[model samples]
Target: MTHVVGEACIGCKYTDCVALCPVECFHEGPNFLVINPDVCIDCGVCVAECPVEAIFDEKDLPEAQREYVELNLRLAQSWPLITGSKEPMPEADAWAEKSSKREYLVEMV
Candidate 1:
């Protein structure tokens, strides 16, 4: 199964995971990143690269974060593809440790 980008990624938006993805399945939103389920290779390489541990295999996703599967799919279709590394949000370090960030998600670029 494909990997899902969860709430921890909402404001952090670290691109370390994006650079490790062989298929370039990542999509860039205003303040987050999503994996295009159709394009993801399920390589699992991006998992450890994530500073906030936001990436999870579809089958291994936490119960509370399951909705991110659909969120990733939906947003990936509309957001621009992100194939390389980039600076994260200015407050990424602060946001990374904060919980319940889904509400901060931005649907657009």
Candidate 2:
């Protein structure tokens, strides 16, 4: 199975995980990042690097965040692939500990 990027990444948009993704499975949106399930190598390298702890193994995804599994898959198809690290959103630190950020997600660049 693949890894999933959940709501914890919505506004944070930290790219720490992107740099370590061996398979280049990461996709970047205006305010979030997603893992392309079809391409992910399940290397688990991205998980520990994610400062916000947003990455999760598919089987271990929290019940409340299960929808993120599909969200990542669908959005990855359109968001540009991100193979390198980039700056986090300006409010990243502030949003890192915030919850229920699903509504703040931006699907476009």
**Model 1, range 11-53, lDDT digits (tens) per residue?**
8889999988899999999999999999998999999999999
- Model 2 C-alpha lDDT per residue in residues 35-62, reported as the tens digit of each score: 9999998999999999989999999999
TM-score of each: 0.97, 0.97
Give me the runs in candidate 2 sitting further than 4 Å from their true place. none
Global fold similarity of model 1 (TM-score): 0.97
lDDT of 1: 0.93
Residue pairs in clash, model 2: none
- Superposed on all Cα atoms, the candidates' RMSDs to the truth, in angstroms, are 0.6, 0.7
Relative to the true structure, how large is the alpha-carbon lDDT of every model? 0.93, 0.92
